[model samples]
Target: MKIKCSKILQYGALEIVAIYFSLLMVMSLLTGNLVYRRSQSLLAAAIIVVLTSHLYSDRRKYFITWGALGTLLASVLYIYYNLNDSSQVYLAIKYLSFSLNESCLIILTVSMLWQRTKKFILVLLLILALIIPIVFWGYYLSMDAWFASDTLLAVMQTNLGESKEYLSDYFTVSGMAAIIFIVIVAGIVWRNMQSVLLVKEKKHFTAFISLALLVSATACYKTRDNLILNTGWKAKENLQKYADFQKMQAQRKSIVRLNLQENGKQQGVFVLVIGESQSKDHMSAYGYDKKTTPWLGEAFKQDNFIKFTNAYSCHTHTIPVLTYALTAKNQYNELQLENAVSLLEVAEAAGYETAWLSNQIKYSAWDTPITVIASEANQQDWINHNIGETTVSNAYDLKLLDSLKSLKLTDKMLIVIHLMGNHGSYRERYPRDFAVFSDMSSEVGSYDNSILYNDYVVSKIYEYVRSLPEFNCMIYFADHADAVEEKLGHDASKFVWPMTHIPMYIGFSERFRQKDAAMVNILRNSQDKVFTNDLIFNIMLGLMNIKIPDIYEQENDITSTYYNSDIQRFKTLYGQRFVREDLQ
Candidate 1:
């Protein structure tokens, strides 16, 4: 059967566009993550196919066969990208765009290579068939999570014995079935190609090659900043990142000198209590109608204890917010996370012994930047032994206090306590005795009860430290809050006021407050200022009175006299949306 050039162009271009949109629309509806911008990219790709349709004028059979195959390959890759669980909608769409671009590049490269030499045709078929096993593994991973750079990094860290065990666990009956299916499909495709032998007959050169280049250029242009989401690209990128992290780890050994100018305390027990999913709106000390924070309410009466009413979290998630909060990276800064200096490193540099105590899990299957930072501390204790986001534990925040008590005392100390306060499964967060709002069976009631329990835990920590002879300073802050009204946690996609409006407080011993009266007064006055958690790194330094001139921006330090509160324009989610707009 013979097909006209006009018919080929009309059907080929139209079919490609139709299939692209149909896959995108179905995946978008299923995942509920893709945004409108992805559709624009897909449209651009379809337009490139239409404009470059004349390239196939000379070789109709070759064009039709390769075009159909490329579309199928692209669709499979698109579905694989959407399988990721934690990726943002914008990022998911970007990954989908990369899949489209990758498929186009594969078609262009393979066609050109086969046209030049017929010997590697069978080899190409084998390589193409290998995609089935790769996709099957991806599908298996998506049942729990999806492939990421961290996944590759985890595999690299594992021993040979562990790797063998891990592979055997996933090599199920279905996996074997997929392998068999791909072998049959590859045989059929190879036989069809052998029957046609179209590459031997292709004689036209200039027009086809010109169109191919234009199509490749279009694909590259549309794939800006999205990057490839496949395992191979991610592994290469993560290897570079891991290398950079190793450099940062090496940099942590040397002592960094700071000219405090006779202003900060270098010898005392400084306690930083990091709360979880705790919103100021639900706390009595922050003017909630309920007595969710009764202990804090009483503590507010004392001159040493002060609460920052307008403080917020930089981001609406645990990892990103804490990553910035515990480092020099701020919402306004252009500093890369890998290059940023963590609080533990700074404390160690200042000649203070640092301890990290957490009620959260110690390890994740993927890369845990928090765990990396936490491990840098001189002493570390993690109460929860569960793995990553997949598992949940009932380890109470009080366990952190027990861990803190077990640590050996040092003269100059920095103790960081990470509490599991009010993180999802709110009912499970508190003890039976602390379920004060049990009579009221609403989600808000459960959340308030968790806050009540957290209040007790914070007060107990304060009580324990106050009993100590060494001058003590305690600062309590949450990573981010929850939006109970919408039944959503701190999801970046669903931005809300409660997610950022976290609870924050600082208390000093009488002796220390008398000595550092100037710093205490500055902090007291800045209580009402619009403070974000990202600026906490500088403030912690200020509390310790360790002044690294280059690293510490006084404008970002709440304890500094020059602290700026004019950052009403500061935004979250990498400055995509203004946080002030969500502030009620």
Candidate 2:
């Protein structure tokens, strides 16, 4: 009996093998984790593809249509991976596989709607047309940063005006060219490949395949951390988690009690200044060659000031760092962020009027966890308004200090000032007058200028706070550091030791210094010891002499006698690795 070639090719068995094996080979080559479990995932994915192979009866059309569109999408990923210096090879391959899986999904869905394939395809194309622009924007962003869940959160947490401003700043010539190229290519593909269609199949078969595909997709999402499975879904998951966190915080706030001991005066002010993307190494006070921190350098001479020489941020991203830093959660603690009480709550419970003055956006599409924590304060002042969700704005950090003057200071106040200091687009962070560094063209120069401006802003804030009749103590620390010299932002994907080395210092008034001599001495001695911002909650409590025994561990507080400087063992990036080992 002669084997008919048509029978063999009718079900697209050869096409399935060709496409599946090619994808598998590419993915396997990119990653070292081709172990038994991962292999099982690959096998399961292949089975789903095989089950759906019958939909593509016209093998030629299937290849042509998806091939053209896939290449276009692949080109963007290629550009992104090439531009993103920190992109690991395995992750790139994982994303590539995700792209193929996403294409498979589109194909399966379109095939199921065989009666209206053309209409479905048209609708899909239109959707892609809209989504592609955002993808293009991300590609341009990848030039200086890696895409992450945090990046998505920031994007969602911005209004249209800010989003437009962000696009204008990062949108480049290459991005425009790429968009034009994709549009022209996509138009040609759509015009020519409109005839592609799935075979007329039974409704029962279609339903079965659809269900199978759904299960396959769910399994893949559960097992793999890839772009297709993770991006939007991960962002949604984070938002839900934050919602849960808000609920938990609401419950915890009512029961939280601070152990406060009033020394002499019950009426005093304490200020916490949170800086943005500032590296301690860039400051002259930290021994940088440039005098970018003249004011801080001068402040070092004051007996009341104590600068922490060895401070690290637990995470390089703003949300994670701030989430841990502002709350009773740290790298060393097992407390879930959702359940932890924030510094604002602690301060509020202690009968101190808490104010959150920020040069950051008040709210975006989604309220970031940081925003939720910030909202817990009795009084809130957002100076930036929505000058884009990012710190790349003219709002400047100094405005926050000015806003402080407007607040009705109570007898006992806890003021938290969040600055937009030295974030990205460093030139925009400061005015021309602060551009003391001659070479404004270079990244190094612009970054130093921003630092210099930050120093001035912070010093001015210090002077104003110190001059206040009731102000007694102040603490300043950055969310995370930037590798300005290396032309790198504080992206966790490309994290370097310097990215965690943020500037941290505390100052006391002469009256306050005399009141808490032992606390001041403890902090002074612990300055040279290793500290991470995640424990800022503890130290803040220590400053107010508030002790929640279950939540606040004395060892983590720099102001405590039992304070431990052994933070080398602390982990970051969701406790995947040790901070010290990463430093090494």
Candidate 3:
């Protein structure tokens, strides 16, 4: 037991440094501060301790064991607290835990084998210990500003738009920080080499660590819910998601989703206008008391349009909802949803030239799932690329018009218009003159006015498509809805109706109606059917009048009389699903 404890103490000293550095990194993550701020001062103090190690010879005996235990304890605490996938605290917990385990294991193994190659093993151990601080310090400089997001991780890898430019900026910012980190690391090693030698063992090592861990446990328990720790985990998870998405992209090319039979000569413009953060319950067209959708109500009066009263978004957030909505995967096929070919790809395979136009943003530190879906377009335009969340943009949904007009004319075109819709800073979503709901409360009025602005944008697009000589049809649906609860924006919710109940409409030009009156009648008859947006690809396929084998379900599509709705089938706001009869 004495021999074993001596071996542990000798090698465990290295693990102590690992623990100290790991603590700095983990604490920095918990506080949502840069590693440099925590590490630089910590490293300097460590250097001072090492330079005067001869004066603290008695303290060295028991320090390593306590550090090892403290590090292990800290890692376990971080892992225990950040289990929530969405928590910002979840960000760096995964990597930090893995690194702690790896560092401890390496030190223990190298220490056990110290008899045969003591000098070489120690050198290797020393180099490895330096890695913990060196890499984290550089990471501090490069990824400090980064929030854990699929888009942020993707920005590091892709050549698309401003994401690549962000990476270029990363190189420039990390240069000076890297030099300072190396210098500090060098100073610590120069002064600490003698102390890294054999240290005397003491009996009270475990007692010291126990007290430290007890104090640490209390601190950990107190700040157990800090959201920043998940930031790193967010980046890590999104990177995995991005990888899965890329794999799906590759596999999607070989999906061979060509329709077996054609309904007719497929030549016309099929427009899919996707809106953001808009709740149907808030819109007048969907029975809201306010005139939030006056122009949309006008379109509703026309015989060429069908408004679906029972449409719900699959997910509360924009990215995930879009993943299922624009793809062939529905609730039943969600397990294989990542591999599902996108609607744009399906339209292209069905022999239509595709275009994507967006008014919200192009990229925000990452290639958004919507951006990946839009990548399938032959021509794509993003009107605004600003990365600020609180930005009061002068840009409006009407800017999508310029992008639409820029597209080269093709006989059979599938154009997707992604709108800002009722996204927050609602007042900024439209011009001040369009604030028709100003008489209402400020928050509610701004939101209602944004909806009113969306009504005009949708009307203009409908009119534009109708003016085109070719047979034209358009479908508009929000990506997801928002809850204006005390003026709060939409977030991940377990049971919220306002955040998922989005408005959907299908509009056909007179020429399109003349050519496909049967389909128009089908759409009108099925408007009241309750369905989730996950199965919306079926509706989109119906609008394009081309169906892929094994993916389309007539029973779930709003354009089919066979459309079925049960309490369990289309899960809505809460535990209670939408009933078609109740909708009426």
TM-scores of the models, in the given order?
A: 0.67, 0.83, 0.63
Ranking by TM-score: 2, 1, 3
Best by TM-score: 2
Which tens-of-lDDT digit does each residue in 333-416 have in candidate 3?
544656777888778778789998887565443365567778888998877766443233436788788777778978899888
TM-score of candidate 1 relative to the true fold: 0.67
Instruction: Give per-residue CA lDDT, model 1, range 1-584, as digits (tens).
Output: 25687786678778677856765675566466454554666666655554444444334454454454444444443444555453455544554555555444544555456556674774665466347345544434323234444345445443443344334433456656655665665555444443333232445655566566677666765565453344556656655654565467656434243332343445889999999989998898889998999999999999999989888788776666777888877778777667677788788878888999888766542344577778878998878775443224547888777888888988789999998788766767888897777666477888899999999999888989877777479999999898876665555544667788888999899988998899999888888888888888999988887776567789889898888787576666546667677654
Residue 549 in model 1: lDDT: 58
Who is ahead in lDDT, 1 or 3? 1
lDDT of each: 0.68, 0.72, 0.62
Per-candidate clash tally: 1, 1, 14
